[model samples]
Target: MEKFKKRWEITQDWQLLFPLIGIIALAYTSYKISNAVISKFGVIAKVLLAVALFFILLRFTLFLFKKLENKWILDQKWEMIRVFIVFAITGSSSMFVGRPVIKLLGITKENLNVFIYWILFIIIGLVFYQILLVFFGFLFGQFRFFWEFEKKMLKRFGLGKFVN
Candidate 1:
């Protein structure tokens, strides 16, 4: 327990609960998604696919957490988990925004060339992602951290001159 706190840079025992809650939430969501798949496929196939997906999501989360840990200026290690949560929310929100925009523009995989559709989709998604990153960050109580991150991202894309 002590080592865990130290590694995560958590100061109090109660702070551990955040990560615990995050883990439980992730597990529950994975279970629900797996069950949804099971309804469409056979038991054996769905079970294997679900298990594979669960691991993949877990690994991806960990990878993102580590990447954020390196890039963001976090006060504690456990905050990486929060950052991960905000990032996931922003990404999903971006996709949600992008989908409607694409539909509104009458751009569909069936109508447009597949390559063109995807390029437009990704471009729209990227724009929404940048906007949502700060909105969600503020909602998550990590505005400063995400604001800095957004600046860095924009700079990397050659848009830094417009930011400040």
Candidate 2:
């Protein structure tokens, strides 16, 4: 535990929560991904797949950490887990928020063309995602990283004039 804390630069007990949450979230995601394919497999197979995916996902996350470490400008390596959690929450919340807004706007798959409804849904979700990303970033103490990310995203969408 001491080694783990030292590795993550965790000086306080409360600061350890983020990494724990990150691991729990990752394990759940791995299990879910495995469950998706479990209909064709037996129980033992599902367990195996989940374990395999957990390691694979862990590896991918570490790869991302390695790649983004230099680019993200963080004071500590552990902050990446918090940033990732905020992003995950923001993305999931955006879809949930957009769904109700779409209904309130009297737009639905039943009324609108399916393709058009999907396109509008994606657009609305993306807009809400932008807002929630910054909100969650501030909440997670990584506002600077996400603010820069948001600026770059806007520039990519040709909304640079507004940001500037």
Candidate 3:
């Protein structure tokens, strides 16, 4: 417990609950996903794969928190959870908006080659993702962070010229 607190720089004991719950939730999700993929495997293999995936997901979550820590406005460790939630919403929103637009445009996997269909899907998804990032960020009370993030992303995509 002390080590976990020190490692994450968490100040209060109560603050620990969110991360702990997050880890357990991630582990359970990993277990469920691994089970679906490895249902034919032996119990030992399934347990091993689930454990491995849990650790990988945990590491990924930590890495993502570290990377985005500076970008988020709140300095508290628990805020990482909120940031993650906001990102999750933004991502889902992007997909929600992208799929309908693609269908409306008659851009279906059945209509185009698999490669082209995927390329178009990704392109459209990316555009919706950028737009929804800011929209959801605003809804989540992190408008400035996402607005800046959007600008940076657009700049990288060579659309900076239109930003000003």
Candidates' RMSD to native? 3.4, 1.6, 3.6
Q: On residues 36-152, what C-alpha lDDT tens digit does candidate 1 reach at each position? A: 867777777766776787788888888877776777678888888877778878888999999999999999999989999999999999999999999998987899988999999
Which order, best to worst by lDDT? 2, 1, 3
Indicate the TM-score of model 3.
Answer: 0.72
* C-alpha lDDT values of all predictions: 0.85, 0.92, 0.81
Please provide TM-scores, in order, for all candidate models, with all chains considered together: 0.75, 0.91, 0.72
For residues 34-126, write the lDDT of model 2, one tens digit per residue. Answer: 989886888788888999999999999989988988888889889988988998999899999999999999998999999999999999999
Of 1 and 2, the candidate ahead on TM-score is 2
* Candidate ranking (TM-score, best to worst): 2, 1, 3
Candidate 2, run of 10 with poorest lDDT: 37-46
Error of 3 at 64 (Å): 3.9
Quote model 1's TM-score: 0.75
Candidate 1 least-lDDT 10 residues: 23-32
Model 3 stretches with alpha carbons more than 4 Å out: 1-25, 41-48, 67-74
On lDDT, the candidate that comes out on top is 2
